[model samples]
Target: MKKKQQEMQQQQELQQQQQQQELQQQQQELRQRDLQQQEKQQRLFFSSSYFISFAAAVRWLPPLAFGEGKNLTAAAAAAAAAAAAAAVAAAAAAAAAAAAGVAACFFLRKEGEG
Candidate 1:
């Protein structure tokens, strides 16, 4: 009877250890997921800020080019065209930057995994 009790106690302890390990593994996975989400958000924020600054520059510079005596209609049209071009360029650049960032992250993750 004593031997049977000892065996049962050992089995219970092993089960408890296994449960603890599983819980730890789950927690680690959750932390890793959170880290990945944070990194993604950071990349998005960086790209968006870059685009916003570039757009602001595009919007602000056309007036300077027109100077103090330029025709209002011509200036407005020029500004519109400049804004359109800048928007396209900024979008492409932002996309490229974001892609590069994500790729770099993937490579770093691979390295860490290995």
Candidate 2:
């Protein structure tokens, strides 16, 4: 009986070890996927249509703010500055929302897998 118990214990230990190894592998895969996602996001950020739109904005905004040929009045310049600030704030909020959505989806997927 003692020999049988030892055999059973050894089998149990082997199963536990295997389980631990599988868990480690899973964790490593998750980390690799996360890194890949971050790299993809970085690439997307630099190559996105939004960046093109931002470039167009940069090209167009100066003429609008300064006036094409006519001198910009002080009040008009202040108004343009205020509008630009509001546009920046809105863009920032949108970016934050998108980032939060991505994070939420990632965590939810992780939770489901766990």
Candidate 3:
């Protein structure tokens, strides 16, 4: 009877150990998933921030340049005109860049889903 009891106790202990191991594995997997989610979020935030900064620079730089040129002599008129033209070009480029960034994000998302 004592031997039987010892054997049963050992079996119970083994089962408990296996359950603990399974729980640990599950916790590890959950942690890894969380980390991956955080990394993805960080990437998205940085990309958006970069896009915002680029857009703002494109929008404001031309006017700032033109304003500074006004402080100069008669050449300031020509410089201001050139700055305005450059601003238009910059706006077009910013639009193109935004489009490309959006396309890239979509492509990456598709790849991740696959």
Predicted model with the maximum TM-score: 1
lDDT of 2: 0.68
Tens-place lDDT per residue, model 3, 1-87, is 999999999999999999989986886687577557655765665566556545544554665667765534544454555556556
Estimate, for each residue in 1-114, the C-alpha lDDT of model 2 and write its tens digit. 999999999999999999989988897798678767766765565455445545544655576666665434544655565567656755765685678668868976986698
Candidate-wise lDDT, in order = 0.71, 0.68, 0.65
* Estimated TM-score for each candidate: 0.55, 0.48, 0.52
Clashes of each: 0, 0, 0
Worst 10 residues of 3 by lDDT: 70-79
In model 3, what lDDT does residue 113 have? 83
RMSD of each: 7.0, 6.2, 10.8
Candidate 1 Cα errors over 4 Å, as ranges: 61-114
**TM-score of candidate 3 to 2 decimals:** 0.52
lDDT of 1 at 25: 87
